[model samples]
Target: MIYCCNDHVELALDVIVDEYETFPVLRKLKEEEKMSTACEYCRKEAEYMVEN
Candidate 1:
Protein backbone atom coordinates (compact mmCIF):
# COMPACT_ATOMS: atom_id res chain seq x y z
CA MET A 1 0.00 0.00 0.00
CA ILE A 2 3.04 2.20 0.25
CA TYR A 3 6.26 2.74 -1.61
CA CYS A 4 8.50 3.02 1.39
CA CYS A 5 11.94 4.60 1.62
CA ASN A 6 14.49 3.38 -0.91
CA ASP A 7 16.98 2.34 1.73
CA HIS A 8 14.38 0.32 3.52
CA VAL A 9 13.19 -1.26 0.33
CA GLU A 10 16.72 -2.01 -0.75
CA LEU A 11 17.52 -3.52 2.61
CA ALA A 12 14.50 -5.71 2.24
CA LEU A 13 15.57 -6.69 -1.24
CA ASP A 14 19.02 -7.44 0.05
CA VAL A 15 17.85 -9.89 2.68
CA ILE A 16 15.48 -11.61 0.31
CA VAL A 17 18.13 -11.76 -2.36
CA ASP A 18 20.61 -13.05 0.16
CA GLU A 19 18.45 -15.89 1.40
CA TYR A 20 16.65 -16.65 -1.81
CA GLU A 21 20.07 -16.32 -3.49
CA THR A 22 18.58 -14.91 -6.66
CA PHE A 23 16.02 -12.51 -7.95
CA PRO A 24 12.82 -13.27 -6.13
CA VAL A 25 9.71 -14.61 -7.78
CA LEU A 26 8.02 -11.43 -6.50
CA ARG A 27 10.11 -9.23 -8.77
CA LYS A 28 8.31 -10.60 -11.79
CA LEU A 29 4.83 -9.91 -10.49
CA LYS A 30 2.80 -6.76 -10.58
CA GLU A 31 1.95 -5.45 -7.09
CA GLU A 32 -1.55 -6.78 -7.45
CA GLU A 33 -0.32 -9.87 -9.21
CA LYS A 34 2.16 -10.38 -6.42
CA MET A 35 -0.39 -10.01 -3.64
CA SER A 36 -1.68 -13.55 -3.90
CA THR A 37 1.71 -15.19 -3.82
CA ALA A 38 5.14 -13.64 -3.39
CA CYS A 39 4.08 -10.40 -1.74
CA GLU A 40 2.24 -12.09 1.10
CA TYR A 41 5.18 -14.27 1.93
CA CYS A 42 7.52 -11.29 1.93
CA ARG A 43 5.07 -9.31 4.00
CA LYS A 44 4.88 -12.12 6.49
CA GLU A 45 8.60 -12.60 6.63
CA ALA A 46 10.38 -9.25 6.31
CA GLU A 47 7.76 -6.53 6.57
CA TYR A 48 5.92 -8.08 9.48
CA MET A 49 8.67 -9.02 11.88
CA VAL A 50 12.12 -8.35 10.47
CA GLU A 51 12.72 -5.27 8.38
CA ASN A 52 15.31 -7.16 6.34
Candidate 2:
Protein backbone atom coordinates (compact mmCIF):
# COMPACT_ATOMS: atom_id res chain seq x y z
CA MET A 1 0.00 0.00 0.00
CA ILE A 2 1.16 3.52 -0.74
CA TYR A 3 0.72 6.34 1.74
CA CYS A 4 1.43 10.03 1.53
CA CYS A 5 3.17 12.15 4.11
CA ASN A 6 0.01 14.07 4.96
CA ASP A 7 -2.45 11.21 5.14
CA HIS A 8 -2.46 7.75 6.61
CA VAL A 9 -4.63 6.10 3.96
CA GLU A 10 -3.13 4.10 1.14
CA LEU A 11 -2.62 6.02 -2.04
CA ALA A 12 -3.77 4.72 -5.41
CA LEU A 13 -1.89 4.87 -8.65
CA ASP A 14 -2.65 4.14 -12.30
CA VAL A 15 0.35 1.99 -13.06
CA ILE A 16 -0.13 -0.60 -15.79
CA VAL A 17 2.32 -3.46 -15.55
CA ASP A 18 2.56 -6.87 -17.13
CA GLU A 19 3.58 -8.24 -13.77
CA TYR A 20 3.44 -6.89 -10.24
CA GLU A 21 6.95 -8.09 -9.55
CA THR A 22 8.27 -5.91 -12.35
CA PHE A 23 6.73 -2.75 -11.00
CA PRO A 24 7.94 -0.49 -8.20
CA VAL A 25 11.57 -1.41 -8.38
CA LEU A 26 12.43 -2.42 -4.86
CA ARG A 27 15.71 -1.17 -3.49
CA LYS A 28 17.51 -1.26 -0.17
CA LEU A 29 16.92 1.91 1.76
CA LYS A 30 18.74 0.69 4.83
CA GLU A 31 20.58 -2.30 6.17
CA GLU A 32 17.29 -3.92 7.18
CA GLU A 33 14.71 -1.90 5.31
CA LYS A 34 13.77 -0.75 1.82
CA MET A 35 11.48 1.72 0.03
CA SER A 36 9.67 1.66 -3.30
CA THR A 37 7.59 4.71 -4.09
CA ALA A 38 6.22 7.96 -2.70
CA CYS A 39 3.29 8.42 -0.38
CA GLU A 40 -0.10 9.86 -1.28
CA TYR A 41 -0.53 11.67 1.99
CA CYS A 42 1.90 14.53 1.67
CA ARG A 43 4.09 13.63 -1.24
CA LYS A 44 6.72 12.22 1.11
CA GLU A 45 8.51 9.78 -1.14
CA ALA A 46 9.60 6.84 0.97
CA GLU A 47 7.69 3.76 1.99
CA TYR A 48 8.39 1.01 4.47
CA MET A 49 7.60 -2.26 2.75
CA VAL A 50 6.89 -5.53 4.47
CA GLU A 51 7.60 -8.57 2.38
CA ASN A 52 6.06 -11.87 3.37
lDDT of each: 0.40, 0.37
Q: How many Å off is the CA of 30 in candidate 1?
A: 10
Residue-by-residue lDDT tens digits, candidate 1, 1-52: 2222322455656676787677633233345643443233334322221222
- Give the C-alpha miss distance for residue 41 in model 2, angstroms: 0.3
Query: Where in model 1 is the C-alpha error above 4 Å?
Result: 1-7, 25-52
Scored by TM-score, the top model is 1
Model 2 steric clash total: 9
Clashing pairs in model 2, backbone N/Cα/C closer than 3 A = 3-39, 3-40, 4-39, 4-40, 4-41, 5-42, 6-41, 6-42, 7-41
Which stretches of candidate 2 lie above 4 Å from their native place? 4-36, 50-52
Tell me the tens digit of each residue's lDDT in model 2 across 1-52: 4433323322223231223443443322352332545654455654443221
